[model samples]
Target: MVFILDTVMCIVTTMPQTKVPLSKRERTARRLTLCLMTEEKQRRPRPSVPYGPTAKTVAEGVQKMRKRRQLTIYELSALLKKAGRPITPSAIAKIERGERRVDVDDLMALTTALGVSPAALLLPLKDSPHQSIEITGAGEVPADVAWEWASNERSLPLSSGDASEAELGYQLHSLPPGRRYLRSRPVGRAVEALRRDVDRVVEISQRSQSRHPSEFADRLAAARLSLGRLEAELARMEAEREEFDRSSREELERLRQEAARLVEEQSRGGGDDGAGVD
Candidate 1:
């Protein structure tokens, strides 16, 4: 059946159309070829959708970075090729013109060629620190906020209020351990800074009490109130950290066990196959 179809296709395609009267077999072959071509066209994947805002940002960044580095489109293409992810200069041009969508592989190659982070390409240029960026699903956010979120410095807050540790943990859970540490570092430093401020205020209050007993009452009361609020915040942060740690350990163990199970199953399957062969 396949050979017959191939022969029909070859005759129908290679034979030139002529004004001569057609034979019955020739007409049948032509119909079969037309049907097969239509089916093949239907089976082919559709072209990608138009580039979105994020893709436009990457395109702009690629062009901007390339120019800043004193590279032409061809030079940038050469660099990408050297990095083992070659994009033709014409395709790079289309990408810069927002006529081509930059996929993940292209984005990585562009980042390497442009000597910038993927976040740098993904985020729009910071014309002003206060400029608002329209991130899909997240709506509009400040440029600095967008950069921070993209860089994994902090999680993007989708809600109206401040993002809680649970949200942060959720974001960090999928990240590797090194990235999780980096992402959580800024918050940890802020907590430590607040603790130091509370400590300093308490030490000052104690010294004041020793020197001027009368003034110490109001000062001590204010310090106590402030300290109480800060202490509550500190405790909440501590609890959240512990919770994040516990969840991370559990996830890691689960992944490890899943991997081991797969390995064991593959080994057993291999042994059975070998026995069957013998």
Candidate 2:
């Protein structure tokens, strides 16, 4: 009996132990640990698409302007919604981070919301005037230069020589007549003033010639010199005007011919359609 009892005790000692049920506190602690692990995984950064130089410029510009205006992302989004083009705060955040591309519609909406011009967002002209910006197919150019070109303040520096005939035609066609001649107004006024001065000097010289020949000779010489300068300036202005007129006429003629050709083609097409119907 003693041997059997000892054998039973040895078997019980060697037997595998069963798992114990966890207490409430221990189970709760385990659940919390798993939740924390999942939260950490969720917070990990994901890969983002790289943005282009232009997109980066726009993003930076938007962020800079927003900060300058002391506007929150939510406020800007609200403003955009009020402007009839709604963009959410999340989308605005993505745009400012360059994680999202700003399309034409988005650009217009952002410009309106931010109270800035499209050019302001497109270029870093205000934030970093001296910085170089890369234009696709155009290579790198100064920010201010790009802004000026974008704003139509000046043409691009693509050509070393004077603007080509095609460029002149484009400008003449695209811009209003008043805007085209706006810059020349000052030149015109200067020319008129010079002409008046020349006329006054000539009149004075002529009147003084009868009274005092010596005085008249000196005055006449000065008047002649002034007249020569005025004549030269007028000649230059006349040449420029003639060139502009010639270019304008040529462009208009070309457009007329193009329109006539298009009309003839349409007429032929119509005739063919009529024959088919018959």
Per-model CA lDDT versus the true structure = 0.75, 0.72
The numbered model that scores best in lDDT is 1
The lowest-lDDT stretch of 10 consecutive residues in candidate 1 is 192-201
lDDT over C-alpha atoms for residue 191 of model 1: 53
Q: Which ten contiguous residues of candidate 2 have the minimum total lDDT?
A: 9-18
> Any runs in candidate 2 off by more than 4 Å, and if so which?
1-50, 126-131, 159-163, 166-170, 181-278
TM-score of 1: 0.49
Backbone Cα, N, C clashes tallied per candidate? 0, 0
Give the Å error, residue 35, model 1. Answer: 17
lDDT of 1 by residue, 1-278 (tens): 87568656655666536787889888777767766676678779988766667877888889988999999999999999999999999999988898788889889989988888998888886623338887767877887668766865556766765568656675567568865674466555455445444544565565565776655565456556656665676788799999999999999999999999999999999999999999
